[model samples]
Target chain A: MGRVVIDVMPKPEILDPQGKAVVGALPRLGFTGFTGVRQGKRFELEVEGEVTDEVLAEARKAAETLLSNPVIEDVVSVRAADGAAGAGA
Target chain B: MGRVVIDVMPKPEILDPQGKAVVGALPRLGFTGFTGVRQGKRFELEVEGEVTDEVLAEARKAAETLLSNPVIEDVVSVRAADGAAGAGA
Candidate 1:
């Protein structure tokens, strides 16, 4: 089996309440010296076979159309999993 | 400034409703050949200054204590951002 990892996050222009809340909580929780906090989502998908370019493209399409809301979020990446590139597990 | 990316996710054994929902939705949404979908969180923390080992350790502590629940979730990584290693942004 192969795997594709997709990372999605709110656009920089968008207001992320969850991220803001985390930023606010950190100082209250005694963790300091951090200026910004942006929270996002990560998805690990296990596919039936090799993760070819076609698979990666389809994954990106899925991310763009279904996994994330384009109005406020951005799909940062849709790539084969792990450090190895252009190959499947 | 420096960025520490902390990735948190539900343990492999834990039931992830959100992930399951996505998995179920994909095939209906015309994206097939996927077997598993695991969802997680990614936090990008921009620190005030250089990211020393001390800063990394503190980030790890924050992730362990606040960002992730040890019982059902795991902090996958707490590290300096990007390709460069052992350095600050």
Candidate 2:
């Protein structure tokens, strides 16, 4: 069966303390060369069977409703697991 | 400037309650066609200027040491933001 990968991230204007913490820790750990960082969430959904248009539509609906908070966060992309990041409907 | 994206996910055998919660809510929300769900973390590192080899290596080091917990979670990939996901040193 195919899988749909949904990437959810906070809106750019939103303050991401978790991401900022990581960025802040980088230099202390002696690892540098980064200016800023943003952290987000990714979800992989393994479909019981084939991945079809209907499946993608349902996945999108779920992403819009449950997986991500439309207010402060957005669904970056919903794509097939075996495919590219933006290869979803 | 270019960016690097690091994807961190819990091991497959690990019990992901967050993913399960989302899966359980899917059907109840009238969305179906999936079996299992996995949740992960995605980090977007925006370099101040350019994305070079040294930058990527440092990013990987950061991923291994800071971004992910090696015991329970693994670094799925460290890639250039403009490039494909697995395209990191």
TM-score of each: 0.89, 0.90
Model 1 over residues A1-89: C-alpha lDDT tens digits? 88898888888888999989989999998999889888988888889999999999889999999989988888887889875322210
TM-score of 2: 0.90
Calculate DockQ per candidate and list them.
Answer: 0.44, 0.44
RMSD of each: 4.9, 5.3
Model 2 chain B weakest lDDT span, ten residues long: B80-89
Off by over 4 Å in 1: A83-89, B83-89
What lDDT tens digits, residue by residue, belong to model 1 across residues B1-89?
88898878788889999999999999998999889998988888888888889889988988998888889888877888865322210
Clashing pairs in 1: none
